[model samples]
Target chain A: MAAPILVFGHKNPDNDAISAAVGYAYLKNELAKRAGSDAVYEACRLGGLPPETEWILGENGIEAPRLIESLSEGQQVILVDHNETLQSADGLDAAEIVEIVDHHRLGGLVTAQPLRFNAKPVGSTAAIVAREFEIEGVELPRGIAALLLGAMLTDTVIMKSPTTTDFDRDIIARTAAAVGVDPVEYGMSIFKCRSNPAELPVDKLVNADAKEFELSNGNKVYIGQYETVDLQAVLGREAEIREAIKGLVADKGYQFVLFFATDILAEGSQFICEGDTDFVNRAFDIDCTGKSVWMPGVLSRKKQVAAPILAL
Target chain B: MAAPILVFGHKNPDNDAISAAVGYAYLKNELAKRAGSDAVYEACRLGGLPPETEWILGENGIEAPRLIESLSEGQQVILVDHNETLQSADGLDAAEIVEIVDHHRLGGLVTAQPLRFNAKPVGSTAAIVAREFEIEGVELPRGIAALLLGAMLTDTVIMKSPTTTDFDRDIIARTAAAVGVDPVEYGMSIFKCRSNPAELPVDKLVNADAKEFELSNGNKVYIGQYETVDLQAVLGREAEIREAIKGLVADKGYQFVLFFATDILAEGSQFICEGDTDFVNRAFDIDCTGKSVWMPGVLSRKKQVAAPILAL
Candidate 1:
């Protein structure tokens, strides 16, 4: 039999990343059982789960995937949530990535073998994994459904983020029903439970949910997003956050660092950036005369923000 | 409504590439019709269709897609049979690629937006397109079934190549039944019509069905395959073919160029290589002491040849 396949997400595991890894492994194993395949599937994580992810998994009675520092040469793996090798686990270059189910922009990941790569323009990787279950005609357990629903709601910001699609909304409703929860009530509770800006350190707040991008002009930019019900609290600590962002930018040699504080309740975001001020001003159409700027109705970093910046 | 999406395959259009472009466009249009979407799907070709592809389309009463040299900036496109920018039309970097359906190894193709990229490890892109039809519950037309079946048979060498999968076989059977033809008989006829190495000039023979790969060692190699009933006919013109290959290598600046003369009837191949003999010997485990080496039961360039060479 082939060695067990390791299914994991990128480093700094978030709610969608952790949920996608677990959900994809379950779906693969169920499909394998129907096909009578002998290969085993194990869900893993590149880093320790964030507090919100830990809470969701614990509440759903799902054990958190084991954290792995690195992989051995020729180890088979299935990546979920992210495809950039920089974002993946250490020694990923030596691993045989058999499948990738991602919802982000394509990174420069090339493989020797032609494997199954399913990337869709959806809000969350969990919605894609849940759709796979529906496509394969596999019945989802209540626990898995809850985890996937949680991921969908978190990633799409309760269907208020610009990244949210009709398909995401459809899957959220079905998965929420399967788990016996009202999506709106549950999503709000999950957001309120996780959004504790006052308690989180400036570093943790900026690095909680971040993505790095290498632009065509060879500029590396990091965008970090933090969602909360209380945006004013985050803006109150703008000076400390700016210092943290500057430190991160210098340490990581990032050309720019932009941290977005998304107000889930207000349906907008405030941006604190340490980068080329002129470029930032033109990209967002906001006059950043101060350290922070409130950009109303700019909830999605993906469609609303990243797309235009990357295109430029 | 968005502008009509131009669907096309890679340069040097083969049967699979041409057929897949047509089939995928048809499938997408059918799905859009059911959903009442205003987006029109127009099939196109990056290069002129091969003689065999032309014949097949003529037999099915399907007009050949308009040949296009390059795309304008921001023109929306759905690539079929290939995803490599190197193999794609010029200005592809500027084009807004919305979706990709392919069966080849992933090249270094990075997109700014998250699009629908469905790449599977199947023998033919036609098979993947047919599976999409099934997934979307769209019934295939008789003409489309014939075109797709012809592509599947040709790409997999009538189920003899190592790239042939069970899913490909399943699609072939269904497509054959829909087209009202015996799969074996129809496949043999297509091969017989196309496998005329003696009639083809040296350049055309090598350029007929070729794929370029960039190795891990930063070496660019071009592997070209020619299918025929008799390998001896190719061996008789070895000197001329070698000269032609050397000219191609010099003109294209390829690190290595290997041409495989595959005998469909014998189910074996003869190799004529023109670069780094030691590396070639180590790559395929064949002693190429002379210009030509006959290897038995090595029919697939993708699975048997390219995979190992690229891995090395």
Candidate 2:
């Protein structure tokens, strides 16, 4: 067989990142087989998996994606859940990106040749993968459907996220039915299965779902979100989290590292910042210097946290 | 009512450029209406319309899209057929790009917000637009179908260009059936409708359907393609074409200006390059520094010409 195309999501992967990569790789493999091509796709991850992703994979009897750090020059890849170069693989600049399935803002990526880029301004990348399976007339196996649906629910915060559009709702409802689960109940279970925030390594707690973004002025900033049912457990470790992110700022020359803990039950997030906080301060009109600020109804990091900061 | 979002193609509008914009704008308006959105979409063109596009619009009783030079700050827009800022309308950097429907390679675009980017490595953007109408369950008006079909055939060179894929072939066949015309006959009609290259101004002949691309080395280059049934006519005015393009090199500071005229009947192109020819020479293994060189079975500029040159 020919070499397998490495399909992966962004670094510091969350549930959506791993799940969308796995789902899309599966769909692409199916398509290759149907088209009588020898091409193969192998799902891979760039970082430690989120706890919820681990639970969903095990629950569905699927293997955890293999972890890879860098890519060989000319190695083909398909990016899922993210497209920005800084957020992708270490050597993505040298790799050949054959396809992209993302649900994030365009991030100044330039390609020499045309490729398949299917993106939507929807709740999650999993929804786009699921929709593609239907479009290509491929059967979405039960195990795969369950895994993708788990990501859909968590990414959209059980459909309460403002990013959840009619497309997301429609696909989520159908995929939930296919998986034979109530989306909200399933979403809660997944969130509850996450590692205890107070017990996780300080660096892990601060970096599990963080993403690096380049500001308009070309400075880099890191934003992380940790969603939980019990906000107190995460808030209690605020000093430690701030210290961990502060180390990142000092070590990596980041302009700022803003860490937030989202409470799924309360539908709010607590923001903790280290390094220059001017952008965050101006973006939300709130103070977060050396202290955590709770913003109500701010569940989406893409819409609520990163967008406004980048806008500045 | 909210301001109507302007939808436009790239500068140096080709048949596919103008047609894709019109088709996508119509589909978006239909989708907005179905969703009961107060939003409206107005088709616009960034450059002079190609003769074939103007003919098709006139034949269908459809008005040519309003020509626009630049966009106001914060003007919401949708880009079709092309994506690079260098190839788009003036002041695009200050405008908000809400969506992109294109078939070209990604061109280093960055957006603060996620968008609906529906692109494929197909024959034409028109093929993707037609596919969307079916996916959205929107009616394809006969006139609109004919317009998009004409573009599909011309862009693919009647399904002969190497860029033409199964996706393009399937969509073209179905759309041709709907338009009630033979694809080859219709494509030839459009190609013949183009202004005679020999009689046209040398500047227009060189710049029409041209685009500026950024080389990996950070310098800019211009690649122009003129598809005609009469290659001799275009080759006959080599001195004038060279003078016009050489002027662009000095005035615009382009590293090179590579002009090629494709003969639809012969399925080949005659390349007449001005300015730096090192990249082109190394890419094609041919010397066209002073004289025109004929390349057989090279119809698609995107695949046969620009891609190789850009790869360097």
Candidate 3:
């Protein structure tokens, strides 16, 4: 018998990463069963869950996926939520990536063979996976429905993020109805239940939602986003945050490091950086104090942060 | 108004590439019309159509897509049948790739932003486009149905190639019925109308259907397949074929170049390769006469030839 395929998300997985991996695995397994194929899919994660992901999984009574630090050569795997080798499990290039379901920009990941790659410009990978269920005519269980809806809500900030698409909103409404919950209320609850940054050490806060990227010019940039109801608390600790960013830059040899304190209630974000002030000013059209800048109505890192930085 | 998004296939487009681009554009336009969006989609091609593709287009009375050499920066585009930068149009990285519907392995093509990338491990890109039509609840027009069906038939070699999937077969039957033609009769007609290699120069015959790849070890491999009614005609000129392959290898600096003459009638293939004879022998387990070898029932370059070669 063929070995079961492992489905996983990138390290430091967010809510969408966790939910989409599980949802996509369920969809694949259901399709295989209908076709009488002996293929099995096991959902996994590259690292421990964040506080928000843990809360959602517990609320839905879904078990957290097994943690896998690395994959061996020839191991068959499917990636969800992320496709960049830097964000994936260690030794990912050695593994056979059979499929990828993601909602992020294309990274430097090449496959040795042709596989099913379903990527979309929507707010959440869960929306893409939910659409797959609809396309394949598979009914979603309540737990899966809730998990998918929660993912979409969190990723889109309840349809407020710039990344939200009409399809994502439609999937959010449908899955929310399937799970018997009000999307707005549930979305707010999930955000409220997130870990408080004030309670964590400066390094932990910076690393909690961090993502690293290699620019076209071969320079590495790291961005960390912390979503909260209060941004002033983080702003008050600007010196500590800058210290943490400096430590990350020194340790990882990053050319630049940025942190965004996103206020979910205000639908805005405060951007802090420990990078070249001239580049940051030119990229965002703001005077940098080597500290922080207030950017109202900028909550999407993919569009507002990563796009401009990559363009540079 | 936003400019019309150009939908195109790779260079040296085959039946599947041309048909999928046109068919997908039609489906996207239909969906946009339903949504009352002003976004327009124009079907295009990066290179000229082959004889078989021209014949299929003429039979359905469908206008051919416009030929495009390169795109300017920020031009929105959608790709079908291929996603590799080496095979795509010039200036593809500068253009905004809004979507991709392909059947080939993912290449080193990185998009600046997330887009809709619908790739599948199926036999034909037309099958994926047809499935998209079904998903969007758009009824296929007679001309489109004919073009799509013809593409699937040719790409899968009348369901005889190992690359064909059950999904491809089902799509073939459904699309054939929709076009009011028996699949077998139409498929044979398409094959019989292909360009006769016996009439063309050896160089042209070798270049007509060539595809290039960069193996994991950074070696370049070029594989060209010619579908013919009689493989003996090609085998009879084995010396000339080898000379053509050698010319290609020297001109392109390829590590190896292989030419496969696939017999539609005999359901087998004659392989002629130039360069790295030892590696080719080890890959296929055939004692190379340094000229040609007959591999009965090895009809798929993607599955039978390329996969094994890339594995090395």
Candidate 4:
């Protein structure tokens, strides 16, 4: 048999990423099998599973891949979803990373080496893989199409996202149509299926869009976004939102905690934060004197906000 | 005091539905408050919360609504994700269904009566709710905006579904931009977040897309989608897929079970079955004599595939 193609998702393996790795691996295996190539394909996950994905996968009759915390020596590793992060993928054999397909911001994990890496600033790595399959003239089975289409649709926010390209839309349209989904209607059903809110907790609200970043001092700071139509309405819940954020800070033991009170209608951001003043000053270019600061025009932490602060 | 707008989501509440109901109620309340009107808004769930939604809600510092079980008399209800189904909403008042914003096909539950229902066959009920916020001139807060945005994006599968419309796209664009999301980057992030899958189970693969409909004889037939890109490549795995379906049938005790195997490239559906002759015969217009049923132009059981078979 040919060398096995070791496929793994990002450090925080999510449903689409994990499924994409699996689906892509399955497809690749088929190609190998048909070509009479000595190759075996296996899917792997770096991190533990999220609760929701766990339930969904269980209900769908998909087996979880064997956990591979880090890449093994001589194992040809293929990365999905994440840009290689050395810290997260520590202990992994770097030479084994032969291919990378991801949709996240490129981080400092990839080594300068020869690899078939494709990083699209699109919505999903699955979309990239889907494009690859299309380009390679590989036929997609319904399951693969469903997962890939789902990933593309989810990532591109149904093509409403600014990251969506004509290519992404075209692929999404074709994939959706091929899967026999009135892409629009099917997308709607997914939304409808998601709206039921019973037995939910308030802490989940804070962490819903939570992310962690390592500061220059190696301290971990947590940033989260809570979007709404009206700032005042969210402001009215400020006590609760703040209380929850404080609780998260205490629990997570982070040096900084920030919540973005974004006004979707106003096209503005209100920063609710507790952290060092010098750090804040450097990050936001604003001088402040208290543990709390609310600023405007900081709606984006990625392009407009985070990078600037990180530079400071 | 203006009448309380009673808000309720679908049966078996999920994160998107619950967040939409709560988030929209908050927005409406804010709008009413700004006008100096004390409009009482109560968020209710159509059914009990699913396990995963519970975790998210709990994490978000939001509380799940009281279990409705069904509709009752005297309460004015605004339907979020669900249509009016007595069985689904056992004890709640149907007469109070003043408005319905849904993304699914209109069921007998709501159509039996005349109400201000908006079922535009979009991707998510949150999109409908988002529209409501826009039309009412209610500004969205970051939390509500993020929640609604997430619901819309996730359900629409990032707008790859055919049911998506210009309205959906416009809303998503405005919302993503307003929330300071590079609609592309944010959409891509959410999709990437969905990639992890180490915790998934084998059974979930078969059940994630399972749907059930009652026959005229009180028999309930369930059809599930187990999509893949290549089935023949894993020739031995077909047996596993089939056995999984059989196990589900035995476990769930359904009158019949049908699994749709779709070929995305070939654009056809392969029906795998373990059901009796009558259920299979009625559901598919073909003989069920121990062979897989291959149908052209069949994919979604909810729309393209199931309706025709059920009508038969």
Off by over 4 Å in 2: none
lDDT of each: 0.87, 0.92, 0.86, 0.60
Per-residue CA lDDT of candidate 3, range A1-312, in tens? 668899998777788888899999999999999999999998998776877778878877989988888998888999999989988888887899999999998886776678999999999999999998988899999988888888898889889999999999888888888888999999998888877767778877787777888876788889888888867778888899998888888888887888888998898999888865455677799876575888999999898888887877
Q: Could you tell me which 10 consecutive residues in candidate 2 chain B have the lowest summed lDDT?
A: B303-312
Q: What TM-score does model 1 score on chain A?
A: 0.95
Docking quality tier of candidate 2?
high
Q: Write the per-residue lDDT of candidate 4 for residues A250-285, one digit (tens) a residue.
A: 877777777776554455667776654466566666
Judging by DockQ against the true structure, name the best candidate: 2
Q: Model 3 scores what on Cα lDDT? A: 0.86
Best by TM-score: 2
DockQ for candidate 2: 0.89
Model 1 misplaced regions, further than 4 Å: A275-279, A287-290, B217-219, B276-278, B287-290
Number of the candidate with higher lDDT, 2 or 4: 2
Tell me how many clashing residue pairs each candidate has. 0, 0, 0, 117
Tens-digit lDDT track of model 2 for A173-202: 999898899888888898889889888888
